[model samples]
Target: EAGVTQFPSHSVIEKGQTVTLRCDPISGHDNLYWYRRVMGKEIKFLLHFVKESKQDESGMPNNRFLAERTGGTYSTLKVQPAELEDSGVYFCASSIRTSGRAGSYEQYFGPGTRLTVT
Candidate 1:
């Protein structure tokens, strides 16, 4: 049941270099989230792991942006010197369990990785 996998979809670095974006979730999902939408704003939640710790990073959007979920399946988002507003489009969502309330479920998106920092 692999429904989330993002990589090199579109990356044009230049601002400062360093860009590592990779996300693969959908196997026994334990809840993994990392959203973004620079420019117009709206989608902004760059942290939320539930397997390899980091249950909530409080929307990380600084410190060069760095996220990882090693043994938790697959999840990586590293944006080093890359600046220029960090470009946009960098989503990696995975859902399976969220308190069982079923109020905010269905998070399986992984077709984004477009970072153009010119």
Candidate 2:
């Protein structure tokens, strides 16, 4: 019954440090997604998870970013050797699968975690 939740609402680190972000989705929801908005950029999808498997990851930027959903309960995103350009807000969302109906299923979002790389 809970909405999506993110940990460490804000993070600040040097350009080469590593940072990990976490997200917990609503119970009984099988669809989990990650998004981010960098400075001067639109919110872009990073990846999606259906249960414990990755459904889509085409949007992931590069090899420095990694995401995982263990047991499909919660998800984690890690950025290694972070760059200044990575400073942005990371958002997580979840949705319940609905029957074939346009706009029937709505995705609930979490309070984004803001990351700043100096």
Candidate 3:
């Protein structure tokens, strides 16, 4: 089985620019998540998607960010008018669906996309 994969490995952009990051989760995984680490902060959850529907998105920072999982095959995170605070490593993770229980759903993460906003 293949692991989660993120496109563009790295990106550099000026402030107010728009950037889109893509992630392809492992085949057959139904639960996808978007996470990020900005500067000194710990890796934080951005959103969660179950198949093609958004399951949770409380961690999203502001209206400038948008996440989508069309057809539930891959996911994309877009930052419009990117700001300096958005510079960081964006991570993608996926897991199989499981009942609500501890340790039942193990997540596999991708290498991450590094975004640098100037």
Q: Which residue runs of candidate 3 sit more than 4 Å off their true CA positions?
A: 99-104
lDDT of 1 by residue, 26-98 (tens): 8888788999998877988879888788888888978888898999889899989998988999999898866
| Every model: Cα RMSD to truth | 11.8, 1.4, 1.3
Index of the highest-lDDT prediction: 3
* Tens-digit lDDT string for candidate 3 (6-96): 9989999999999999999999889999999989699999999999999999999999999999999999999998999999999999998
Decide which is better by lDDT, 1 or 2. Answer: 2
Q: In candidate 1, how many clashes are counted? A: 0
What tens digits encode model 2's per-residue C-alpha lDDT throughout 1-118? 6788999899999999999999999988888999999995999999999898999999999999999999988999999989999999999999886676543258899999999999
TM-score of each candidate structure, all chains considered together: 0.32, 0.93, 0.95
Give the lDDT of residue 85 in candidate 2: 90
Ranking by TM-score: 3, 2, 1
Q: Check candidate 2 and list the clashing pairs.
A: none
TM-score (C-alpha) between model 2 and the true structure? 0.93
